[model samples]
Target: MRRFRPYLRGEGLILTGGMTALIAATIMKLLEPWPLKFVVDSVLRVEQPTDVATVIGLCAGALIAITALRAVFQFLATTVFSMVGGRVLTRVRSDLFAHVQRLSADFHEKSRAGDITLRLVGDVGMLKDTAVTATLPLLGNVLVLTGMIGIMLWLDWRLALVALVPLPLLWLATRRVTTRIGQASRAQRKREGAIAATAGEALAGMRAIQALGLEGAVSRMFRGANDRSLTDGIRAARLSAALERMVDAMVGIATAAILWFGAHAVISGRLTPGELLVFLTYLKNTFRPVREYAKYSGRLAKAAAAGDRVFDLLDQVPTIRDRPGATEAPAFRGQITFHDVHFAYDGGGAVLAGLDLTIPAGQRVAVTGPSGIGKSTLLTLLLRLRDPSGGRVVIDGTDIASVTLASLRRQISFVAQEPLLFSAPIAENIALGAGRDVTRAEIEDAARLADAHDFIAALPMGYDTVVAERGANFSAGQRQRLAIARAALRHAPLLMMDEPTAGLDSASEEAVARAIDALSADRTTLLVTHNLALAARMDRIIVLHDGRLAEDGSHAALLAKGGRYAALWRLQQGGRVRDAATG
Candidate 1:
């Protein structure tokens, strides 16, 4: 409720109007039984009564008017509440998405993409639907029940007490079953999330799955999750049904007891037949809320579980955020320093241990290392994607952590080994790097610089071409070129590439290498790669071993030293020579 308060405050006036209509409907319901009471006592049972037809006609007319007005109020209340609910949830979804985006990379790495997506889309949607259908109607029915119970007590307190005897029993039964139902519903929701995660993983890796001929294995995994979800769902349903049946039996027992007691009172002249009829009507109406709860128990239980998931995500504070008094960073000179930096993933050994390094402005450096070395960790620390467990990274004499993340990252351009392109126009994908409005001519210029303009222009839609998911529509070379073009558009002072041409063929590698050379000119560049041939082109090369700097010098200098770098170089050169001889 506290989480919702902020959003609900803006809808106060609209919510007030809805509540007004709800109250009016409750009053109309209270009046509805009175007309029938008048028809019974004043017209049907009266002896020597004048104008009986007029009296009966007036009662019927009043009944119709009350029913019509109640319907109108009910409609207003329902529509207004539904509209408010939709608007509130739309904002919530938008905010939740933004929050998810702001969370640190570590959170994303640990969580399944599909489970996070389910919370964002599926869980929030379920909450919105339940608010409109089950929650609002239940509120209205509760108001109706309260009014009817009050009227019943006013008509005959003893008879009203008799009718209320089964309420405590009903509550006990509801508590026991609803608790189990809620537990089952929560389990069912988790199972559903697992199913979604499995499906998303399979879809994203469909190419790999097919190539490996593992369709049967994947199907079995999916089936397991689906079956668990079905089992829990059925359990919840059964519990809800049992509760409803219990309520029905209790209502029946209470109604029978009331009829017996009220009939004796009427015969003894302690109550009028018309009053007894009204009491009976109120008794039935009073229990309507209980029946409604029983009916919506399954949905409400599921909604509760969904709400927990949604709010849990919303409540999570981003691990990475701007600090207090953090100001925008000035234009960077591209000088970087790692002062005794140390980092490790959660519950893992250090990936970077007491690493000290420095790069002068406008210097191009290459980082080469064995697999699982901390070469990439240096770049992530610079970008503040993951903070160091100890020590700090300084840029241009200022600690990067002292500046706003947006300001700090704005001066750096990054190109990953496998760049991710969204399902948008080619032009839009390139423009994302600009971080500002860009003209079509500028986009074309950047594309040309990356050697991608020729292929893009040859397409039927050119820059308007929509990329398929993960840029699957483009070849590896084409994707790399597009990524280079994006980085070119960024025009940042610092450029970083992580094996940007790792898996490319000779021709593709040559093209990508040329574009990278152009992009790296006049910028402070850090390239991480296993290719010693590419590293040889840089001004200097640094080799990492066992989370520490093993060798640092020019490629030729390190090779002449005959240390770790020489050993790695020899291993790679030997493999290439063998491949050439075999060919």
Candidate 2:
């Protein structure tokens, strides 16, 4: 919580004005008790009746003006306070998003995406209220309480001491209960985010769960998540209730004692009847801030919890951060060289073991391997998504590890097995890399190159049509082609695609292949695919077996070698399995 203080530190200027107005409001509120004393003493007991009437009229007018001014100052103070809180929120989110973007691929491999998203949206929103309302107003209340206590002691020390009897006990209870509430609130918020993450993941993967007939299993899991949140939330609420009841008892006891003691004093003539009435008025006014403070206690605790969660996200140092003094890369010449490259996801055993390979500039190479045999890992290394554990990957004779991520990513285009598109117009997705310079002609030409323009033109809004989230409205092939169109817009020197046509039918695959060929004309491209026929069409093939390079040569030469490549090709084509030596 102390570390979370930076979220409030940027509001120095706004807090200055707010504190001034809050002090003004507090002074006006303090005027309320004195006017009751004037009414009791001057109008009822004074000698000259007309003079008393005049004095009373002036006090009434003064009191009315002060009450109005109090409202104005309170509004101005809280408004500025909220503005400052809003400014901090902007900085918090901006930093959080930037950190998320810089986080390494390996971090993503281990963390659930839905959990990350919950931190971004749910946790961050909760922190905003803490600064805007809870913390600042708490300060104002403390000041009011302090000023009220001072005035009460000045009026009569004996009466003020009587009022102080229950103060320590109430303060002690507040301290203990608020601490409990804070811890409970933080735990509750985490559980709440976990529930959202669980629900989001379940909803996003609903089709998969249904297709696999796991509806009951997913339901039970969601129920468990919901129950965890409920349990934690109930604990937080229980603490808040205890705090309220304790505060209520303390206020009741203090007020009753003041009246009991003041009555006897009025009877004894040490305190006047008018003074006793004013004492009662001050006793009630004293609890105004106390009640306000108690009311906001739960909200403040909840907000503190949320602020920590958001700051946790903001504090997450990218696991794969750029080294200090990293240099920017120029255009990629695409001569990718991996020298004794070794890597892993969690610093465990190497996933890519002593890999060594070099593909010349403008070479179109297909990497074929078993599902988990590090083919994708190789592409990750080449793209600088994860730096190698043991060696360097150099592009254009420059080690990629030394370059800035922005420039390194700029030189290469990546299309995953499934294209990730937002729910936006097709033109925006296709020309995503063009930023502010995306033109109609450029978007169409890129679309045509990916063989996606004709189908796009057939849509209701042509390129302006909105695609559903993750391109759900379009067929798989259409999404892939649109992805290619986006990559084509980059027109980068290097391209890396993973199983680009794995899920397409023959007709769809035909369209996808033509688009890829057109899009990757002169670039150095690495295509990771299990389709041996697609591998055969590439200029060269590298067959990976068990995290090692098993074969590297032209497809025809590898077929002639009668190795694993030839065996896979034969098996895929429904031909006899050859008893080949290289296999």
Best of the candidates, lDDT: 1
What are the lDDT figures for the candidates, one per model? 0.90, 0.81
Tens-digit lDDT string for candidate 1 (1-583): 5777798877999999999999999899888888888877787784836998888889889999999999999999999999998999889999999999998998888788899999999998998999989998889888888888887888788888889988888888888888999999999999998998999999999999999999999999999999999999999999888888888888788879988999999999988888988888888777778888888888998889988998888888878899999999999999999999899888888899999999999999999988878998888999999899999899999999999999999999999999979999999999999999999999999999999999999999999999999999998989999999999999899999999988887788888888888889999999999988788888899999878888999989999999988999999999879977986
Clashes per prediction? 0, 0
| Candidate achieving the largest TM-score | 1
> What overall lDDT, based on C-alpha atoms, would model 2 receive against the true structure?
0.81
Off by over 4 Å in 1: 46-49, 573-583
- What TM-scores do the predictions have? 0.96, 0.93
RMSD of 1: 1.9
RMSD of each candidate?
1.9, 3.7
TM value for model 1 = 0.96
